[model samples]
Target: MYKYDNFDQTIVNERVEQFRGQTQRFLSGELSEEEYRPLRLMNGLYIQRHAPMLRVAIPYGLLSSKQMRMLAQIAREYDKNYAHFSTRQNLQYNWPDLERVPDILADLASVEMHAVQTSGNCIRNTTSDQFAGIAPDEIEDPRPYCEIIRQWSTFHPEFSYLPRKFKIAVSGATHDRAAVRVHDIGLYLVKNGQGETGFEVIVGGGLGRTPYIGPTIRSFLEKKDLLSYLEAILRVYNRYGRRDNIYKARIKILVNELGKEEFTKQVEEEWQHIKNSVLILDQKEIDRVKAYFTEPDYDQNAGDDTGFESALNENSAFTSWASRNLADHKVAGYKAVVVSLKAPGIAPGDATDAQMDFIADIADEYSHGEIVVTHDQNLVLPHVKQADLFTLWNKLSEQGLATPNIGLLTDMICCPGLDFCSLANAGSIPIAKQINEKFDDLDYLHDIGDIKIKMSGCMNACGHHHVGHIGILGVNKKGEEYYQLTLGGSAENDAALGDRLGPAFAKAEVANVIESLIQVYINNRDEDERFLDTYRRIGMEPFKEKVYENN
Candidate 1:
């Protein structure tokens, strides 16, 4: 983790004082609702349906144990005794007092954290693969560059108020765990044929009312030009992107209207001049940033843990959780542990205050003193000793954090729908709960393997419904909530939009509809194929009919 220098600390302290003044003005009626709207948004405060919501940024999905404890304290004192982790790897407090938000910001600033750029028209959080450094498939760690972008974009006056909100994601791994393809700007850290490192820049990818998997704007961009190239892209979008209609404001809409060829040409023309400018990152600075992320001291020669294998064989529960929750770590004798947040009956990604402290303790005790928030609404201990798997599992299970349902049908990504969001037409958390209860069998869920079911309250695609293997969108019909289903969507490499599966279903009928689709998949799947693989191979005709025939 990059500790904030004196300059960074000063920046946050200044913002807290600034936000305090703005908040005072708004409350005292000196700032009208129209005037206060953007100000509050910039501070990551939203007046939701029931109460004010505060979104705190967890930069590139990395947070220290100390920071986690701070969040737990915030949740305990400021809002309800829990916080919602967003799909973008940020945390949301649903019921914070608007008057006290500045205090929250000040508290966050104390721990080198804040809500800056977590919302607003400027650049949002710069996310990356949660398994960035530790993933065996990674070419290099993406965090150094993510941190660079985080620093560059933090207070850039030029991009603070874009046509609409902008998002960026970087993936260093061979597989796209970060869902880079659907961000406004997606950077794939890659090595060229000559072994030179750079980015494969993909632009105009987003999911909202109009969904798009961004086209490759640049085949290869050198590492030195990362910030400059990004500036060029933002400048192009900021110059020409539509500001007339909120619905048509995202860069994806602009890219689609202009076409990729023309967009690429414009970006190239802009990049030509700026590529060699001062914005170009110096190798020494890049190395300095990279130095902060070096691996924890490990037992280098601790090759194979026989005890870990023995634990797996002896305990069925431990083995089950390990199979689903544990992923291969880059280092030997270590594993990346996925703490599933999609526990049954609870809102997905809502970690209670006690749970946060517990998870923080687990990270300190079992893994390194750090945690990574996964895009799939899970917490990850990126470096856990293999021998400690059982102990970690037992501790997590006791706290209702160890579901062992990673990538299963029940492990769904859902937005804080009508329950919290004013924009949501229908409730998403309830739909997730309904679907989760319907598909509660672990064995059955595992059999219907590698399924991603995402639910969104509206077309904003906050839940990333457009990229799930099974996408569910909530719609309001005659003031009643209905759920619409989309099939074959994926956020992985070769990202594609999901196909809609006919008419929407009532809230009560949602669980049955999902079951019908699951049954269809099981009946039609080929040998060893995942839900997505089967969907691509077999197409949507079978699943579509199964879902709609009885409706």
Candidate 2:
């Protein structure tokens, strides 16, 4: 994890003082609710249905043990004793008093964290692949670039107040774990023909009321011109993106209104002027940022211990966890382990103070003192040695953090729906719990195979329902809560927006509807095909026909 320098420290300190004063003014009634809204929002505070929610930015989803401890402390001291981790890998506290926001920001700054750009219509947190360093297929570490963008976008004068919020995701691997396709600006780090590293840039991709899989504006952007080219794209959108209506204000709307060819031409014209400027990265800056993310020291001689294998054989629970939670690392003696937050009936990403303390202990004792917050709403100890896997698994299992259902149907991605969110139409967490409890068998999940079941309480798409293999969007029909289903959506290398499957189902029927859809897939799929591949082979027609056949 990158340590904050004097400049970083200074900026955050000043912002905390400023927000403290702002909170004072708001509570004293000098600033009206309307006036205090944007100020608090800029600092990542939202007035929710019941209470104020404060979102703290976890830059690129990287956290040190110290930072994790700070989060646990905040949960205990400021608001509730639990915090909800968001889909963007940020953490949210739901019960903070409006007057105490500055105190909260001060506490966060103590740990070198803040709530900046977490809300309001500005460039939000820059996301990257959660498995960036350890993933076997990565082209390069994407966090350095994400950090660079964070520095550039933070309080950017011109682009600070855009028509709508802007999102950017960078993926170092060919596999798109970061859901880059659904971002306003998606950058894929690619190697050119000569083996030189560059980027494949996409623009106008977003998920909301109008979901769009961004178009490729630049197939190969040189490493030096990364920032310059991005500036050009943002400049184009800032100048022409719709502002009259909130719904039509995203860059995706602009890209749709103007065809890809014209949009590309406009960006190209803008880039020609700025490509060679100071924004172009040189080796020194790249090295400076890369140094922060250099691989941690490991003991190479720490060979795999048969103890872990024995534990797996002896304990069916451990065996199940190893199957789902553990991932192969590029290094011989190390494995990447995902600490699931989506337990059977808990909030999807809510981690309690004790849970945070337990995981922090595991990170330090077992896998060095580093932790990763995966975009899939899970925590990761990215460099655990194979010899210590069993010990770590035993500890995690003790804490109820050892659900081994990664990428399976039960390992769902869900937003903090109506349970906490004011924007939600129905409850997403309970629905996720219902589905998780319905499909608790790991072998059954593995047999069903590689399905992303994303649910959102509303169309805000916080859970990214638009890109789930089986997407569920909650809707309200005459005050009755219902869910709309979409199929064939994906967030990988071949990203595509899901198509809706007929009418919405009442809250009671959601799990059964999903079960019926999966049954249809099992009956129709060819030999050993994944859910995505099967869906692509035999479009939504078959699943749709079977799901709504009774109607």
Candidate 3:
């Protein structure tokens, strides 16, 4: 984790006080609502359907145990008993008092966390793979570059207010766990034939009312030119991106209208002027950022723990959880344990204050006091010793954090729909619960295997519904809530938007619809085929026929 220096601390502390004044003025009626709107948004405060929502940034999804404890404290003292973790790997406080937002910001600054850029039509949080440094398939750690972007973008006057919100994602692994293809700017860290490292840049990828898988603009870009190249892209978007309609304001729309070739040409032209400027990162600076993410100390004799093997043999429950929740680590005798937030009956991506505290303790005890939040709404203890697996599993199980449903049907990504978001067409949490109840059997879910169910309450696509294996979008038709389904979408290496399954179904029909689709996959799948594989092999006709047969 990157520790804040005096400059970082000073900036955050100053911003807290500045926002404190702005909030006070708004409350005192000295600043009109129009005047306070941008100010509050800049500080990551939103007036939601019920109460004010505060989104706190967890940069590139990294969190120290101390920061986690602070988040738990904020949840306990300020909001309700729980907070919601968003798809961007940020945390949202749904019930924070408007007057106390400054206090919350101040508290967050103390822990080197704040809510800046979590919302608004500015550059939002830069995200990366949850398994960044620890993944076995990674070419390099992407966090240093993510941190570089964060430093470059925060309060950059040129990009302070773009035509629309901007998102950038980087992936260092062979697997695209960061969903880079669906971001405004996606960077895949790669090595060329000569073995020199650089980025494969993709632009125009986004999901909303209109969805697109970003096209690669630069096949290879030197590592030193990263920031300069990003600035060029932003400059192009800021100058030409549509400002007349909010719906057409994202950079994706600009790229679509101008064509990928023209967009790339413009960016390249702009980059020629600045590529060798001060924006180019030097080796010293790169090494400094990389130093913050160095690997933790490991025991030399850590392999082949007999106790862990015995526990796996003795306990079927632990075995199942391990199969689903544990990921392979690059270091031998270590594993990345995913702490699932989508346990039965819990709202997806939400954690109670107690659960947060318990997780912080677990991180300290098992993962070297570090926690990583995944964009799929799960937490990762990225450096857990294999020897301590059984005991860690038991602790997580006791706290309701060990669901063993990672990447399963029930471990869905969902947004705060009508329950919290005013823009929502329907309630997503209830639908999630309905799905959970319908698919309560672990054996049945395991059989279905590795299906992603992402639901959004509206077309804003905050839940990333467009990229799920089974994407569910809530729609309002003639004042009645209905759910639409899409199949075969994936957010991994083969990134693609899902195909719609004909017509929308009533809200009550969603769970049954999902069940029918799953049954179709079960009936049609070949040996060892996943839901996505089966869907792609047989196409949508079979699943659509099954889902709409009784309608």
- In angstroms, the error of model 3 at 49 is 0.4
Write candidate 1's Cα lDDT for 58-85 as tens digits: 9999999999999999999998899999
TM-scores of all candidate predictions against the true structure:
0.99, 0.97, 0.99
Query: How would the candidate models be sorted by lDDT, starting from the highest?
Result: 3, 1, 2
Encode model 3's per-residue lDDT on 189-234: one tens digit a residue.
Answer: 9999899999999999999999999999998999899999999999
Clashing pairs in model 1? none
In model 3, which range of ten residues has the least summed lDDT?
A: 299-308
Candidate 2 steric clashes: 0
The positional error of residue 81 in candidate 2, measured at the CA in angstroms, is 1.0
Candidate RMSDs in order: 0.9, 1.5, 0.8
